[model samples]
Target: MRDFHLLIDVGNTFLKWGLFQPSAAGGARENRLESGHALLEEIPALPAQFAKYPAPSRIVISNVAGTRVRAATIRVLEVWPDAPAPYWLVPQAEQCGVKNSYRNPAQLGADRWAALIGARWLLGPRAAMVVVCGTATTIDFLSADGVFKGGTIMPGVGLMLRSLHEGTAALPDQGGEFDEYPTQTVDAIASGCQHAQAGAIERMYAHEASHVRDLTCLVSGGAARAVTPRLAIPFQYHENLVLEGLYRVSMSL
Candidate 1:
């Protein structure tokens, strides 16, 4: 079987992965063999996804999900006939030209660290603010000098909306389109949640823009689209920020 690369990014609620064929040095890069996402509980499809590519020569994973989900991921890998050596990328004080500002590097989520590296490497040194919106929302900062200034984490749109349902009797636990003025309760919930998510990000972005010159804000994660259009400040949406970071780490490895 031809050798390839595998990138797995496990978040709170989803597992995203990619299979890639190697590229020529400093030349045009080939795209991934396949890239897709699946909810953690929908993991039964793992075998099909794995069958889409050749056995990987390199396998790097960043898993923030706890032991149960990690076990689930490993079980998925068990189906591979030629299982490659897997490296679970962990948080470090610094790596791949980026410095860590977390007082205890181990406390930093590997996924978050990877995103920062991905941002710095993808976007040349300018101040960077990373917004990852998934089951949770994280807003983190990075100085132009490659220091990984710590970030903020909060419940995501789904959680926030569910909170209302769980706490109150009338609010339904469902999502709707974002609207400035909503005629229905669901839309109102969606608007309020989106505004809240957007507000937190803007607050951080505003602060960074105030302190840094020519700042770059990068937003990623599954729920990114939910709040991105509402961003009051300029930003860029990267669908595979974590994968990009994983690729960066792979290169160094």
Candidate 2:
């Protein structure tokens, strides 16, 4: 019946997607039917996955992986020839109630922009610090009134460890478990990377808390497991915020 809406988030390290059915409540709370994710190399599996479902009425996408992946995604999406052209999300000055304060709004990543909208939907009017730990760790501040102030990005946990190993001669490529005080170099590297992510998030949280009362921290992305434990403040983890944001966008159509 072409009732489904497919949501895809093409991130730097992975391409994640969800097939959702409209909710009786609202779009922000849409019912997810099936979801899957794969590394960049596994793009070929997408068509097979989607083949199991009926043709969707609409396709919503947020791609930040650049041209090659964008082309790859478009290629795989040929499985549903009858579906409407995919809606590629582009960040704007404002969308779905969240206002982007980027000096140049177009330069902001679609994934980040979507996450901000999702955060606003999830958190309502509360001030929030949205932290995403993926290929790059992003720390963003969203005011209670739905304005996206600005944020910083840094190398993610694996990226930090990889850079140390690749850029140096003696460092190990694989990091050890997180430890406060480690005598081993592997542990030190792992702990340092984790702490760096947590420290930056905490600092941003504190900064936002100073300006707004009852600031919330919403954490998401692949590396949330490694970094969330190190955070000293309270945070709510969402595994598919980008998809949530994409679904919200799909509601507008």
Candidate 3:
């Protein structure tokens, strides 16, 4: 079998992965093989899922879940001793065609960095706003010239709901249906949280539009479905966006 690359995106809520056959001429979409996600705690069991395929030639990872998850990821690689050392994605001043504008570039999350690269790879010179809704919501602006213009971090749908339930004594932990005017407390909480997410993205999009023409909005992550419907502007949903970015980074290496 041909050698392939393994890409992993470790977010705060889950560990997402993808297998890419770079030797394949079909580009990133066609290069992808088996891909799936598991909760952070399920990292140890990943080897079994990977066992069916031969050892990858390269393993690239973007981990924002912290040191413990990083250690767990390393341990999971014990199954493929022959695979080359994993290349952990660290934010730099510039990488993979995207320039990081963060005051301290290294402070940017690895997953977000990868997503920015993926957006550039997918969109070329187009201006875009990359919104990732997972444990947290991030709306980053990327210029047509490929410069990352920084973004906002806010509570995601789940985080907002969880916070409301935890912080308030009356609101329940579960979500209710979204409504223009929510009658029940649960529905009101759900609508407010989801709308908050959509509102932020819209505001960011409006801001980016004033400076850059023809902006594209890219949305991804687990909670994307819950928030996308509430969005008033146009958007393209990208599943496993961070994983795709990782693949793009691997290609540069």
Candidate 4:
């Protein structure tokens, strides 16, 4: 079996790519994994970066944007024109080791599905709450038995800040940076947006605590640093859960 894998996660704002090599027994800690960010328009650059690794027989993708999907396909064709097109992973009601419990299972975001997969692998099959704070904040719950119970979706910190300025009149157009306890106008906007976002996560944790015995929180994405300090529960931080999930899915097939 080929030991190399390529994982791609396309989001609303950026494209994240990761390369992973299977670990030897007892070599898990030394496994090689490389990842970085790229603009949606810069998809063509991926093939060159990936050239450093052995030619990957398997490529997995979780794309959220139609435009990005089209562009990425074109770029891959331009470079690996003869190679097999990458397999796209869409979240379903059930998949390799996890079952979705969403009201309409397919409606769950692909990123959420990937996060749940990666979270289960890291946190074990315990009751886990995976919070991905990116362009959109997604809070997904996986039961102790590895069942993906339905989760929540809310506007992310950046989206909320942007919305406040774009949707309303009084709110100032401030960048995303909040003080420990905001007091000024800008700080107020920043802190208000931060707390509001963090508050929603807190509520979700509370809601899950009522039903699950052991609630493990896993936080990831661009906005995690902004919200982690405010979270009440002890949580694990993963910089690229979606990408890791993509890698895991590819390995299963």
RMSD of 2: 1.4
Instruction: Report the lDDT tens digits of candidate 1 across residue range 1-253.
Output: 4666788999988899987666634211245667788988887778776775566788899999888888888888876767776889988888987899888897899899888888888776788999989898989888889988788999999999999999998998886777899999999998999999999999888887987999999999899988899998999888878888888887777
Q: Which stretches of candidate 2 lie over 4 Å from their true place?
A: 24-30
List, in order, the clash count of every candidate structure. Answer: 0, 0, 0, 0
Instruction: Identify the runs in model 4 with alpha carbons over 4 angstroms from their true place.
Output: 1-3, 24-30, 44-54
Better of 1 and 4 by lDDT: 1
Model 2 lowest lDDT segment of ten: 22-31
Candidate 4 on 218-243: residue-level lDDT in tens? 89998888888878777888887887
Q: What is the lDDT of residue 184 in candidate 4?
A: 72
C-alpha positional error of residue 5 in candidate 3 after TM-score superposition, expressed in Å:
0.7
TM-score of every prediction relative to native = 0.93, 0.96, 0.96, 0.88
Span of 10 residues, lowest total lDDT, candidate 3: 21-30
After superposition, which runs of candidate 3 have C-alpha atoms over 4 Å from their true positions? 23-27
Worst 10 residues of 4 by lDDT: 23-32
Better of 1 and 2 by lDDT: 2
| TM-score head-to-head 1 vs 3, winner | 3
